[model samples]
Target chain A: MNFSRVIYNKFLSSWMRISITVIILIPFAIGIALLLKSLPIIRSDSIFNLVGSGKWAPSEGKFGFRPYILSSVYVTLFSFLFAAPVSFLSAIYLTQFARGRLIKLVYPVIDILAGIPSVIYGVWGVLVIVPFISGFVAPVFNTSSSGFTILAGGIVLAVMCIPYMLNMLLEVLKTVPTGLKEATLSLGATNWETTKHVVLRNCFSGVVSSFGLGITKAFGETLAVMMVVGNTVHISFNPLQSGYPLPALIANNYGEMLSIPLYDSALMFAALLLMTIILVINLFFRFLMYRAVNQ
Target chain B: MRKRKNIEEKFFKSLSGLTTYSLIGILLFIIAVVFYKGFNALSFEMIFKPPEGGYYYGGEGGVLNAIAGSVYIAFGATLIAVFIGIPAALFINIYLNRMKKVQNLFRYLLDALWGIPSIVYGAFGFTLMLFMGLNASLLAGIITVSILITPIVVRTFDDVLCNIPKGLIEASFALGSTKTETAFKILIKQGFSGFITALLLSFGRGIGDAASVLFTAGYTDLIPRNLDEPAATLPLAIFFQLSSPIPVVRERAYAAATVLTIIILSISLVARYISGRNTFSNIK
Candidate 1:
């Protein structure tokens, strides 16, 4: 009877605390596991030098990651550049300006976009954006491009990233006091001036949080980019050129890693690098959030 | 000065309107393009039947195998994630209520983990599977995906739990209810809709992701028979078809995408309905 009573009371707090701690530690555990798996490659080739060289010819047995790293950075950079203005502006419109009918129609659509499978964006990217850019947009810049390129991937990512950034920005923007805008207007500030001076100023940290989330989302994106990026190891600066990014590289090579010596560890190391980057970025945002919460 | 402000307002308004409209335009374009390309290819048999020869190459079959595989893994992963997530969420808000630093630390960790790329989860899961000497099977996929989404579930559920009124908890306790009774019976009951929404959100993510399962869940022409069997998913089905050289097979990729999109759209709609209906359920 006493044992049963102890078992029953365990539900009040003790068991929940233990299990939750274990569950929350899972990602750290996974990260450690990846680090361990990649230990061989990291030990053989220092991470800095491994990513420093520009060649990754597996047949000849070199696994330099300069190209894929460059590709991931540039593609994500371009995606952020393309997505930021549109996402922030639209979020402002959605929160401060949009009215009943427009809100009813547009808001739900944005929510749907958040949940729309990555595969659809990929399919649409492969079908439309790739051909459109390669055929028309590329020539405007005097470059020959294929449907499969980083530019196409960036376009898909911009669309996918917009909904997420918008969600974050909207949440923060809505919290801006209407009275502040009203007071600014009373002081002869125009609507644009009021929003620029008051709303945007107040939501700066949240804006940072949103962009941090966007970078994380775009950086780790695999499938949508994978379908369109011409999966090549060639390291090029031009977005018009097709190349492999880190996540896509890992996805495509994991199956065949066993056939080659040390290929699996290289891929695991890349994943480790990717996870570390995301962790650092998120830490920056969490600092911002902690400030916001304390304030 | 007034004229300058007027011009700025007009310009900025137009800018915001243009970008907002572009967002709507992009969504419509994606839906239109997918439907336009895949409409003719989408048929009952195409959805209901499994591919005959091979999934990657052109074949004379439906996407039944992939559809089944996606649902099985998603449902299984969601079940596991929910069971794990709810307790973790409760623990954060309830068990650690007095320990603000610890609660914030857990939240921060979950958020960081949530940002970890799904492909990284695949890598981690593959490593785990290697240690156990397992093949790419449905079980591996479910485990990896469960890892991928559990943080997300806990974070969102924590949001709901945090909003539960303190008064409700105190009242339950004042009525001589145990902490367990107050948490599960009252707190969870009130947050039920938000909890369901969290589940739906994670489930949709699990079903939609290809990267997390690409290595862990080995693709096949046949549906997964049991947890140990290999599983094919809709995303992989569409991926294999889209990459095909054959035009007919490329069109079929759109069909597969349509199926995936429809499933996600319906799930989101249901979530909205649930959350909308339960707005008044909070303790007054």
Candidate 2:
């Protein structure tokens, strides 16, 4: 009885210590996020007015994040639109049709691609991708100097994101039980039918979550986009024009300003926005994962 | 009739085989392209000289300084991250197990932090450093990268710790070990391999990261004399040099890139080998 009591006391003390540690660490971790969110720039009286202003000059205390925000969204969306279908179809092919040595080979290649450094991707985009896009795809798209255009950036972004999406989708497809596939096949379903009805239907939530995660990743990407994004703060719907992203804007302008409160606050404000977007997407993914696992 | 069915089956199998092989062929093409373009600019002298003023040719540079900066900054950040992240993870695993709501909240925050783009962290570092009056120091870069990598380390360590069987804890307690003692002696000791993997993974990531370091660490030609000074790294060197119009600088950029790639690849290979060996030993 005494020994059991001692053990119980030890457990209780450990629990308390853990709680104290967590309480200390939680605020330290979230301080960055909170500072980003609560800074004065987002709440400034001229916030709405600044959105319409094309000027980003720090000398006069003018700060406009609209162009960078818009470009980030536009390029991210374009990249997603290109990457999603290709990756989804590739996942379909791998999960459904791949066999033996081929599956093994493809898996390692995808892993390596996922692990490749972003800077390397940036180098490749600048060296090989830009030249190729200029020489080949630019004329087809009717763009001059493909060095810094949305389409060129989007293509590079697509290549970077494909492995991530493919891996997630493949993991999701693996969860569909063998019995479901057999049952569909026995009911006179073709291979395609079995895949669509049995596999994809069962993993719809997983697929959606994967897509959400991929889009979020693409949104936060910096190095490759910075290399090819033309460094101009302009808003345009055209994929053939150069523009800036939030990350690029932050990287480009942060060091140049010495003591402009508005400029520093604006960068913090953008960081806050980026964090919020990431948080929302991750929450959605977690919710979907929970539901998928629970069901 | 059976022989005829066999022939038809063989034909379909061969057709499917061809399509599968073609898919792998496309992946290999991408790798080949990386090697082809990257190799064209490689030379021994370029890797040994400092950068000239011109695009490719003017710099009298080797990448020695940048490589040293990367290793210094990465190792410094990894040490700080491991110190903070491991404890935080341990605390989460031990205390939050019963508090599902709080645990979930912490988990969500961590996931968001992990998902945040490194550039945003770079921006955060830039703002913070400016506020602190440290203008583009290597210390600022290290802190930013440390913050960026913390979530990954915490999550990985937490996962590994949580996977440790409850029975071990119970047994340790039964033997009169204190909670802290058991945690330090048994649980962490057993999970050391996984913790090492997380450390190495974050180290590699920090070494390869360019975007966050770009604004916070700003490029400096000379080697850092102190933590307050600006520093160059392999990734930033590659970024600046590769974009230059100078042929020699571009070639040097390729050499730097090749070195960076090899460093990252070697770390990853070590991670793989360690994990593989662990699994093999476990099976025995």
Candidate 3:
């Protein structure tokens, strides 16, 4: 009857099941640990004031993080301003206007774009986007500055976000079904009329959701952004200047984080802050996704 | 008014067309620039030898150390992810198959995990390492990356297992097969191809991710001698090399990026081929 083998299988099955449950909770565990680690700083420095203050020198016992928070918000919002319109139009082109073979080519290209590593994107940005902007985009403003500016960050992030926005919007556009488009066309509407009045209208919620996801993508980017965001801690709204976001700051200073008092805790707080913002956005995206799936 | 409507439509059509083509142009431009710059520094010594001087210096070494480190950490992480992820997947798809609501929640949690950025994982990994008083090493990196990829593997495997015809599982149960046995014997075989795809995809993701291991896998010019020893990865190598003010070192950075890109591309292509048309993405 091999009773021992049966017991072993049962043990293995149950143990693995429990292990996976633990595995799934890892992010939460880390999140809670970060909150705890950041507690000293949170207790000493009020989070609101801490986040709103611009002085960030831990060596000086000052922990103002408004600059970083504002940088993140501005860059993400600016990136959305650049990405949404371009990706929206691209999605429209892909689903409604493009030929069949072109659609096939573009879809796989986008999928590959998504799979390409962020470091590669960083490298490409350092060489390509940075150069292009510094040489061309900057000259028009009569500025002679290094290439690693916030505008560079925004442009690179906008490029990185195209796949996220395009893919979701593509799905939304496709889900409009052929019959709806055909009916609109049968009414003697032009392709643009059929699309503007029908396709985009059908996916208005999806278009909004894509913008949300795109914002999240831009906000969470670290390596590519750090490479070209000039890595300065100073906060500013000007895209032409160098500024640091939270993830970029963490990636930049994590190595030396333990060297200063409460520096590690501050980094932890920044991590927690980044995760909270992203998670909130993601939760909203998930709700939208669920709605999209239902529709 | 009718003519204005036509003009407006034409205006939008051209605008969208221009933007779409330009987006494609940007992708093509990135690839072209990477290839052109990277090919200049590509050499056997660049790939085969570890750095002799320093990573940032115009050292006489290749990226062998980083390459081996990436494969090692990714392999270890994938092993852990598979060990934990497959069971989670099986639990969701097999044991709890009837619990539609619970499965949806599980899937939702995984989706959220996917949404968490890699740098945040790096931050979390760094915190854990500091708490444990552990140095950045292959083991710490492996554990961190395992957590990073586990959700991906489970989500992929769950989707794959879901696509397995229910009749087959029912048939196994109808034959008086035990729950675990039926799972191992039927679900595994039915879902084998997709399983491999999930494993390789996550492995590629683990290897390609720099932000997650940026802090956990401390850079080394030498290959890791043991699990506790720090290891370099290709992405970090590229980052350091590119950051160097020296032109030769910057050239090598391009070369390293090319290698990393090729490795990732191959892994993805292989995954696509193995999963075949069930694409898993339907498997879409």
Candidate 4:
């Protein structure tokens, strides 16, 4: 009986270890799986033409991704412009000025905002931001839009990203060793001066990592951005113009992929591209963060 | 110099305050817009009954199919994630506790997995299904969503497990407990609240996410009766309905979005309440 019990314990231990191995292998499995699915497009088309050309006529066997890639970049850039200041200032207020009750209240609000589904954001975008842009903002800027522009997508994404960026920024600020702040205060430096010199200096890497993560996030966002970004397969830098992002391209084409030869491969390649870009960005930022911590 | 410094301090303070309050204002406005548009079209039948004929064309019916499907898929996925996640997290924190390098590497990998977008998961899930000769069904969705949320569950649980005092484990060992025994009996008991919170958080995320299930979970107007049947989800319901050219269908989409939001908000509230209550206070 004792021997059986010992064997049973050993089995359980090994089972757990195996589970850990399986868990650890997931990311690699996903990467390989995506690569294999996208292999067809990669083989048929020149790599440079696939990504560098603006034409995306899959029916004719051309799958240029330049327009989609540029659209993703521009939308993410616009989101950064709109969200960075709001989140940064909010982080400063929460960490430096807000008291216990205020912080307590604000934390849950941010969590709620983060917890809201992306689709709902898309719906809200269609309902409010879309009309607001085409009717009010576009007229002011001397342009008429369908309200489904890169600018509308950016505004919606910026709202969705604010809570995430704010949460990270608040965490970075909170880790700024209280002793340093006290020292600066004793030296009679004003609050703004101390924040600019001490808090910002110490958490520069954290801030950078947060923004980098946010950019990767905006780049990969699909359904919400898809619903509002107009899904136009054009290469234009105008924020008010309709654009097609990579993830949006993957999503919008899935239904019709079966009707055309190589269409499935094309969408798979888009998914692969998005996955690779996000993974690379995540890895680079993690490395930067790891080095900063060690230094 | 003193007066100039005071002015600068006041200006920055007010600026920060302005930005912070504006964020709150935006959140409120979003909620207001969703609820307002939703309530106008929301009805008792919309909540209790499935769609009737011609439903997509402003037909009569509640999104009962989608509501039920979302719950079913999210529940199944959360169950799988919990089963996989709890053991892996416990193994990392308990069995491999002494290896700091190994632990950090595991944490870093989990974080990266957490950051990978759900759409990639959807595409990968689709590939896996094809490789396995499976079709888009409830099972595919559950599997895909489980993959998407397992990292979240493990990371959340790991955050709680990391805070377990070393002395507790040492005491358990001194009491002649094996590593497995200590893990299951002591650590699990102590971290029960965190585990529950993790479950709810991942469930909330699983139910709310549309991108990951867009391809894996094929849509249907009827509630799936088995693992092999296609299932509709609330997020996808909203996405499809909102895209329709009909005004009434768009209103139904708003109603669906409202329901999704309320469910997620309640889950967050419950998580906070559970975490705040701090069970096992007597354990210390």
Best by lDDT: 4
Q: Model 4, range A1-295, lDDT digits (tens) per residue? A: 3777678678767877877888899999998988887788889988788999988787898888998999999999999999889999988888787777777778778988988889988988998999999999999999899999999999999998999888767766767788999899899998788899999999899888878887888889888899899998666678999888888888877788879888887888888888889989987886666545445
Cα lDDT tens digits, model 3, A1-295, are: 3897689678867966896678678878978988998999999889998988888778997988889888888778777888899988988877667777666667667767777888888988898878888899889999886888887888888888988888877777767878989999998898898987987778678778778877988899998889988988655566888878888988888778878989988988998999999988888887787677557
Model 2 misplaced regions, further than 4 Å: A1-40, A43-46, A51-60, A259-261, B1-31, B40-57, B98-104, B130-135, B161-176, B279-284
Best by the TM-score measure: 4
Q: Tens digit of lDDT per residue, candidate 3, span B6-45?
A: 9988888888888888877887887888889999999999
Q: Tens-digit lDDT track for model 2 on B1-284?
A: 65665565455445545544544665565556656755776666456554545434654547767887888789888987887777667666655657867776776667667777887777667666766789787899898888878777888667678778878878987998766566667767878877887898889988999887988887776678789988888898888887788776676677678778778778877876665555332100
lDDT of 4 at A31: 84
Q: What share of the true interface contacts does each candidate keep?
A: 0.82, 0.32, 0.58, 0.71
User: lDDT at A191 for candidate 4?
Assistant: 79
**Per-prediction TM-score to the true structure, in the order listed:** 0.96, 0.85, 0.94, 0.97
- Model 4: which residue pairs collide? B46-B62
**Predicted model with the maximum DockQ:** 1
Worst 10 residues of 4 chain A by lDDT: A286-295
- Model 4 scores a TM of 0.97
Residue B177, model 2, lDDT = 74
Per-candidate DockQ values are 0.63, 0.31, 0.57, 0.58
Q: How well is candidate 2 docked (DockQ)?
A: 0.31
